[model samples]
Target: MFKAYFTDGGNPSDLVQLARIAESVGLDRQRAEAILASDEFTREVRQEEQLWLSRGVSSVPTVVFNGQYAVTGGQPVEAFVGAIRQIMSEAKGGTVS
Candidate 1:
């Protein structure tokens, strides 16, 4: 999906394109189309969206560590490493510089 969206220039908002993308990844095309056509999982998806929204997640690729610390948006590997170290240090009752 990421490849189709970013590399192939596929429009994710288009159901037909989405179904095609799903089929490309070995998913049943008809079932994918059927699910997209219906309101299936709509409520559950909305609920999850609301949960993230409530958690102050307003961007893509938001990483929440231990449900406490959050790193949002695209970041370098060092940023994630630092976050993990900080979270681990805090868990061990220590501090990371």
Candidate 2:
């Protein structure tokens, strides 16, 4: 979806483009088109959006680890490794650094 939207100039809001992207990803094109055309999963999507908004998530690429630590933006691999190490240390009751 990101590639289609950002690189391929495909409109993410268009159901046809969405269906095409879904088909490219090995999903059933007919089912994807049907779902995109209908209100299927609308409530669930809205609910999740609300949940994230409530949690102060106003940006994309915000990764939450163990629901405690958040690493936002396009971070390096080392950043993720450090976050995981910190979370693991915290779980083991290590001193907070």
Candidate 3:
């Protein structure tokens, strides 16, 4: 869905079309539409926003490790692997340089 939205210029903000897409992906169309139309979606968004804020996240595309290390914004795959390796190393009482 995100791929289609970003690459194919699909409008994800269109709740009706998003619901249809959800149905195509094996979700119940009526249920998807109901959730999208209800205030529950807004509430969920707010809840997620609060959680992110509590985590000190203020941007999209954030990757965090052990709630201590993070790679915010765009990064290469090597950067992600490096973060994971560093976390694992630290977990093993080893130092990462």
For each candidate, the alpha-carbon lDDT, in order, equals 0.92, 0.87, 0.86
State which candidate has the highest TM-score: 1
lDDT of 3 at 27: 100
Instruction: Give the per-residue lDDT of model 3 (tens digit) for 12-82.
Output: 88998899889989999999999988887787799878987887898778987886788888999999988
What does the lDDT come to for candidate 2? 0.87
Model 1 misplacement above 4 A: 95-97
lDDT of 1 by residue, 1-97 (tens): 7988789887889999999988988999999999999999999999999988998999999999897689999999999999999898888898866
Backbone clashes in each candidate structure, one number apiece?
0, 0, 0
How far out, in Å, is residue 57 in model 2? Answer: 1.2
RMSD of each: 1.9, 2.3, 2.3
* Alpha carbon deviation, residue 25, candidate 3 (Å): 1.5
Quote each prediction's TM-score. 0.83, 0.82, 0.80
Q: Sorted on lDDT, highest at the top, how do the candidates line up? A: 1, 2, 3
Candidate 3's error at 9, in angstroms?
Answer: 0.5
